[model samples]
Target: MSDRAPQPVERQLPTEEARDLLALVRELAQREIAPTAAGEEDAGHFPREVFALLSRSGLLGLVYDEEYGGGDQPYEVYLQVLEELASARLTVGLGVSVHTLACHALAAFGTKEQRAEYLPAMLGGGLLGAYCLSEPSSGSDAASLRTRAVRDGDDWVITGTKAWITHGGIADFYTVLARTGGEGARGITAFLVPGDAPGLSAAAPEHKMGMKGSPTAQVHFDGVRVPDTRRLGEEGQGFAVALSALDSGRLGIAACATGVAQAALDEALSYTAGRQQFGRPIADFQGLRFMIADMATQIEAGRALYLAAARLRDAGKPFSKEAAMAKLFCTDSAMRVTTDAVQLLGGYGYTADFPVERFMREAKVLQIVEGTNQIQRMVVARHLAGPESR
Candidate 1:
């Protein structure tokens, strides 16, 4: 197989600048990312230096205000860039999305002082970040998180554990959500915790099904003292901050899912067109051809779903329902498409010699991350039928 999969689907972009930006991202993905993805993934090595290069290229800060070193791009353009990166390597694409989610709370709700102090460095300083919202006991119901943050003289002493943290051990900083008042979501608060805080540590990285190149771990905060000034938004408002981040983050996952699906479809087509069966290319077989057609259709539908949601966000309107729908449909489509790709390649797709197995593994997490497909359905249903009756 070639170093790269097929080129991306043609995108409808609004500006000359947005089109140019996509070109740049695709070029970088093909050259700097796709070539090394398989080997690095097998080694389970996080490519920190690639992130540095992305920072230098100003790719890391897309969709944020430019005043603090962000790219000032709209979500529509930014998400397409993510799709391209993910097609090359999901570890990079999803990593950038999580980092952006980590930045959302501070950028949206931080005091002017906090933005001036942190945004520039966080956005472009080559510093990676992790979001800490899930805990060992809390998964679907994040409002039930048990981590506690108690007030000190002028500081807050945090104590608890966060689970499934992306970039956990290697992050430069963490955006942590912990209980600060009475029980429940409203009592929680968001804090910007430095990775080197004296009591902060991470458990050994989880051995995962895929995206081994990206680290996931349980991060422990034991009396990690953070000044009140580092708190994001108001006290009792951290859950709100987290929900906001997840709404946007769900869209990011949708785009990444579409990318993975697209890559799988591309590989399957390439393989079938070359492999011969009964003295003819397997592409001539109606069964395989139908499967390829279905995969391509789903990928296109998934891409359109995400881009529509992204445009809603760019227009400054409500997009939560669309985001959830995108996340659900796209991730489900990715699972189906990747599984089919593996089937098309027969035994080779199941082996490490091909990347489809890895793609299938990575696709599983998109269904689970940000929110499960079940949670996505809940979110979308709430929009249509109103909140569940107590």
Candidate 2:
């Protein structure tokens, strides 16, 4: 394979500023991220310093309000930035997406005082955040969560375990959803809890198939207390808040998946172009050439699908169905593209000596996270034909 770096993607950005931003991201990814990704991931080390650097550089809050220390960029721009980061390291890209999801409840539903008091620190003050909605028993049926928050005159005592949380133990804050009333969806409420609250704790991170550098754990709230002031939205409104955040979060995953696929495709192309066999490079073979073409096509289609969904969000239109579509297609495409990359490289692809094997493992998680492909299909169907019959 060629020793040279992969070529920069040709992007049709909206403005000179966005173009400049992409250039900076590409440079940062190449210089600071790509070089050590393999080694660090192999060692299962989380690069907290890289996140600190991203925070200081104002890359952590691209889609939020500028008044509150955010970049105020459009969703289109933010998603592209995620793509660049994930191309170098999926851990960094997906971590930023989860942090953004953690911030959404407060940014969208909190009172003015809440925004002014908390937005700056969470956005750019070098603080990380986690979202807590899923429980040990409830993943897809989130409205049925059993976490409880009881009012105590001036405070609420929260008690429950949140499973599969990204940045679980290391985050500075958490966006928690708990049952504040009775029964399903209508009973839930959102709260912004400090990570150091007396009873909050995290289990050891899971040993995952890939992206081992990113921590995923179960966070426990054992009677964790928070003032009423920390409540994000009105009682019985948490499910809405969670769903709204997820609509945007799914788009972030779609972008990350596309980036992974693109990286894999680049690796395959380089390997085939340089690996000679029987008096010629493997790129000479028509079968391998067809595989490369198909991989590139899938990546392009996934990117376009995500960008379209992002544009809808940027325009203040309803984009839930499109977001689900993008997440489903892009992740599935990433899996296919990465698997093809491994096949193209023959024996080397099966070993950790090459990055395609790692990419293949990473692609599997994307399919299952941020709602599974099955959930995405259900979402798309609901949009098309209304709720399903019980």
Candidate 3:
């Protein structure tokens, strides 16, 4: 096989403004987040302070419209910003992505009144938002969710349990998908359920393997009443809306995966260059050099995939298949890079003294969440098979 691999055609060279934003993100991430990530992860803590800092810096609303105190930037730029934040701390990166995904219902399909009421609090206040789609039994098969929303006069009474919800307890609002009609995906409907709605309560957070700093909980909505005005999109259109939102959300996850891989590769490069093996640095070994080469190559390819999908989104083109492909490639790459990084450090890599073990742990969750790699393959295959398969 040729040593030169196929060049990914999806590279997104950031603009000057994007570079400036990256500089700001890097500064904040290294100075503020890096110091606390380990401690918070060990204690199973959430960094509310980071949200405040991001809000004040206008980083939270980088992709939203300017009218709502947002930057209205392109997805390629926004995703790079997300990557930089995630490289420092996955919790903040995921929190930001979930918030952005939550805004999709309002931004793309909401009524003017709904957007006016909610978009500001989301983009301007850095008030976190959680997407309530996955149920206890319905994970990758999200359309089959059992959550129910019954119409009651001027309000809708929601009763269901949303599982694996990031920011479930801490979010200011939730973009909930519930069954309002009959069965299957078509029966689902979306709503903007305020976090403080009566009868809405969150269960104790789950004990996760990684991203521990970002709380995941089961939110129970027992007869939670929401104004009819809070309904997102038309009834029965919720599944489509949720799918569309997830297509973009998958891109965010892809960026996160790439960041994790990049971080792992960086750590491995630094370690191998300094740690001596047989009177020379480990990097001097040809075998380790080849491994590093593979890691760098995979990370670059993953970046290209995500950026291509992001550009498609920015251009308002069909990008669902591309998003799935990116998510699959990037997350898989992250898992491999982090694993190899740990192996490179030998025993030290397995210990807490180095962050490679943490990166390895963190990379795994990226592959499991946001429609798992298997689901992503199904999505891509369906897309490739044309409308007949779907």
Candidate 4:
């Protein structure tokens, strides 16, 4: 890895305020985040303190309401901020996104009382969160989840296992989905489950290909009780809430994909410029130069696509289709760009000695998470040609 951090993308932020925010985020990414990313990742250490610092800096809640301790920035500003953080480290960037996704059920659909009670701490109290929707058998078919939440007066007892959860064991709280009515999508309900709730236990984190610093575990809820006051939306409305949150979550993943690609491109450029091959620099070769150019172009275009979707969301317009497209295009671009980056570096790229290889590993997960690229295409296809024939 280079001793220096990657340069920030020259962002066209909407306001002077937004510009200042980006500058601060970039500075933090370079100083506090990037400097230790490789070592921490290698050690499989989760930098929870860095997330605390971000919460204190007000970066954790950039897209939520200021009344609830958030930055109240638009999605455009938030996504750009995410891109910068991701450029430094994907774990932190995607961690922030998953936190936002966990908070979304209450922020967007919770009763006003629920919002007033939980939003502040979740936004800036250094309290991390996890979202639980994917289960052992319900990855793509989220509606078919089998977790059960049975009503018992004012309390509901939840029992089932949720898999592939980020922040699974470490989160302060969880936004959980369970079946409260019957089978399928219409049967689900959303609840805010405290992390330390009785009977809530998380399996050891999975040994993953990348983002090892970010925990992915399976949480078991064995008769975990949740109060009625903690229910996020109404009974049988959890599926809608989960889908709504995912549309925005997909945009976050898109921004993260661009960030990783941007980082890979920067590393490739840095290496080629300094590495001598034919008595000069490898960058001097026309073929290599063309590869670099193509990588840069894809990164730029992916950024644009995600930002466009974000703007549509901010404008209160229907943006699900655009969000899915952005997610598909940007993640695929990240996979391609990162692979090209490795090719550009020759043998050095294949080793853990450089960040490009790490970027390549990290990019693979983005295509699979936040609705896999295959899933993103299905979503876009649904928008285009309606649902697939049963």
Separate clash counts for every candidate: 0, 0, 0, 0
Per-residue lDDT over 11-49 for candidate 1, one digit per residue giving the tens place of the 0 to 100 score: 999999999999999999999999999999999999999
Model 3, 1-390: lDDT tens per residue? 112322222335567777777777778888898778888888888998899889878888888889887887899998988888888889988889998998898888998887888888788786888999999999988878999999999999999899999999888899999999998988999999888889999999998878888999999999999988999999999999998899989999999888778778777877887888699888889999999999999989889889999999989899999999999999999999999999998899999888889999999999988999998998898888855432
Query: Pairs clashing in candidate 2?
Result: none
Residue 268 miss distance in model 3 (angstroms): 0.9
| Candidate 3 residue runs with Cα over 4 Å from true position | 1-14, 387-390
Residue 7 error, candidate 3, Å = 22
Residue 238, candidate 3: C-alpha displacement in angstroms: 0.6
Q: Which runs of model 2 end up more than 4 angstroms from their true locations?
A: none
Predicted model with the maximum lDDT: 2
TM-score preference between candidates 2 and 4, better one: 2
**Model 3: how far residue 269 lies from native, Å:** 1.2
Model 2 lDDT per residue over 163-183, tens place: 999999999999999999999
Give RMSD (Å) of candidate 1 vs. truth: 1.3
What is candidate 3's TM-score against the reference? 0.95
lDDT of each: 0.94, 0.95, 0.88, 0.94
> Candidates 3 and 4: which is better by TM-score?
4
| TM agreement with the true structure for every prediction | 0.98, 0.99, 0.95, 0.98
Which lDDT tens digits does candidate 4 get at residues 1-390? 334445657887899999998898898899999999999999999999999999999988988999999888999999999999999999999999999999999999988888989999999999999999999999999999999999999999999999999999999999999999988899999999999999999999999999989999999999999899999888999999999999999999999999999999989988888888769888899999999999999999999999999999999999999999999999999999999999999998999999888999999999999898989998899999998887
